[model samples]
Target: MKADVQLLITADGSHTAVNQVLNKTYHSIHGAYQESQRVYIELGLFSAFDAFPDGPIHVFEMGFGTGLNALLTAREAERQQRQIFYTTIDAYPMPPEATSQLNYDQFFGTSYLTALHESRWNEPVEVNPYFRLTKIESELQALQIDERFQLIYYDAFAPTAQPELWETEIFQQLADLLLPGGLLTTYCSRSYVQRNMRAAGFTVTKHSGPLHKRDILKAEKVR
Candidate 1:
């Protein structure tokens, strides 16, 4: 069944995609940009830079969604002059009409967002001097990435909406992708999810979330 995708204005004046069939939004209803900035950029990318300074950073993101996270990450990379190789996977890639409704350009004031969307999938495309993106058109179950990454943006749909993606087995595979001291950040803070991450060999930590959420989860590979 095709998802009834529609654009909705979030609390922070950004746009989000709501899959009516699944009864879920592509991002937090409170704020799309706010959630991406706090959970993924501030916590995931910046923390990785602090921990692993003076080298290229590889980021693997689950659920590419509206490509908002990718655009934000690309902008940050250029601003900080940091080398970033970003890889994101999505089974259900959004159509151009839906992505066009997301007014990220209003916030960032750059056309890089268009470049990000127009970039070819299943291949690396250099968006700028500091950032490169490889978009994989595949589901998590079919993914077989070889490189161990320093950071992962676990931006999948909520566990309640997609329970199978949050299971122990899935977490185990994700844990194995992390380099030692690697980090994974997400907007989820469910106890069962945290416990599964721990079982997968991560040292999990919970931090204050963005608007409308109490906490977010950040897990690190200690080994």
Candidate 2:
């Protein structure tokens, strides 16, 4: 599937993509870069690293929208000299034409974003010595893998747009894919979503969200 997107500048003067089909923005409109930095990088990645201090960090992302999260993680990996293995899946991969227009490269003063978008799908490519990435072009429900992750970036469209992804079954599958003490972070903090996560055996906690958002979720697989 192809995603028709329109590039838009966010409140933090960063670029984000709006999916015309889903009527949803890839990142928070308030601040795309800020949101990813807070919700995924700081809250999710750093926390996972703290929990598992040694060895390469393995991250699985539910949505690979604009590749912003992966790019930031790769940058952090290089900066901190930490090894990272990132695997991300997307049902409707954004077209190259749309991604080329994003200002992330200019904002970050690097061309890593372009490299990430051009990387081959379903194969791991070392973006740098500290970071390796594998992009999977598939729907989450149809995906099958034996690799377990220490962190999950649950960046799918909102529940209203794709409620199936937030169902108990889906959450259970994700929970099974996480290692013990693994974390799953998302911009969504809806009560029903929390309930589903809880039913799937996760300890859910609400955290302060980024700009324009009240609360986000950081669920842990304590078993």
Per-candidate TM equals: 0.96, 0.98
lDDT of 2 by residue, 81-101 (tens): 999999999999999998888
Residue range 1-223, candidate 1, lDDT tens digits: 1245888888998888988767899899999989999999998999999999978999999988888899899899989999999999888877777777778888778677777777788989999899999999888988998988999999988888999999889988998898999999999999999999999888999999999899999999877
C-alpha local distance difference test of each model: 0.89, 0.93
Task: Provide C-alpha RMSD values for all models, in order.
Answer: 1.3, 0.8
Off by over 4 Å in 1: 1-4
Residue pairs in candidate 2 whose N, alpha carbon or C atoms collide under 3 angstroms? none
Model 2 scores a TM of 0.98
Estimate the overall C-alpha local distance difference test score of candidate 2: 0.93
